[model samples]
Target: MESLIDKDRIQVKFSAENQFAAIEMAAKPLWEQGYVDEGFLAAVMERERNFPTGLPTRVGVALPHTEAKYVIKEGISILTLDKPVLFAGMGNPKEKVLVEILFLLAIKNPAKQLGVLQTIITIIQNEMVLKKIKGAKDPKTIYNLINQFI
Candidate 1:
């Protein structure tokens, strides 16, 4: 299987006004590269609104994703924000977290979703990795760092 973390799919110091914009920015590469279907973005945005994926880790990370039907090929789109954006907390939607990173997931294969999420969660839990990602000036650095965990 091809690696899900493509260097080109990673963006560093990405600027977005809000979480929705951040999700759009992060997911764009996947959609453009045919990793996801045309309606994927809409589905992801809708899912995000209903069941927020923002987690309160050492550094907040948002996992915006939808059902498998929207994915053409499984892939992960990564974005390290220029500024943290507000997203409803995963555990409690009433609370908000300032998300510094966005992991936009496109999973065509349902069985692999849990494994993928767990790997990304491992990355999110490591402050050193999050710091490295935050300080990264280029996508190659982020890609390699994330590839290691994957």
Candidate 2:
């Protein structure tokens, strides 16, 4: 499958005051590009409330996404923050995670969600690649690196 990642949607050196801001920033491009509907942001926020997506990985990440109804198409938005934003940990909502990377997704097909999650998790598990992404100098570099996965 062709990668849903778009270099134009990538954010580098981004800093958000909170998780909500991070998710908004990450989803904005997708929204503007018509990959997702207006309800997408609200859906993502609601979903996050019920099921956190933050992962305590090597470089702290959050994978925020909503249901297919909110998506007009499939795409992934990559946000690399300059400062870590607080997020509710995936498994333990009580635990707070300072996330530096946010993967905001718009998946029109529910079946692809699990596969996408697996792909992201696998990439994040590679410490070297994760480190490379964290230290990437530009959005292009990050986009190029992540494009390898999809």
Q: 1-150 in candidate 2: lDDT tens per residue?
A: 246887888888887889999999999899899999889999999999999989998799999998898888899998989989889999899988889899898887777888888888888999888888878878889887877887
Return the TM-score for candidate 1, rounded to 2 decimals.
Answer: 0.96
Candidate 1 wrongly placed segments (more than 4 Å): none
- Residue lDDT tens for model 1, 1-150: 138888889888988999999999998899889999889999999999999999988788899999999888888899999899999999799989999989899987777888888888888889999989988999998887887775
Cα TM-score per model? 0.96, 0.95
Show where candidate 2 strays beyond 4 Å.
Answer: none
lDDT for each candidate structure = 0.89, 0.88
Candidates' RMSD to native: 1.2, 1.1
* lDDT of candidate model 2 versus the reference: 0.88
lDDT of 1: 0.89
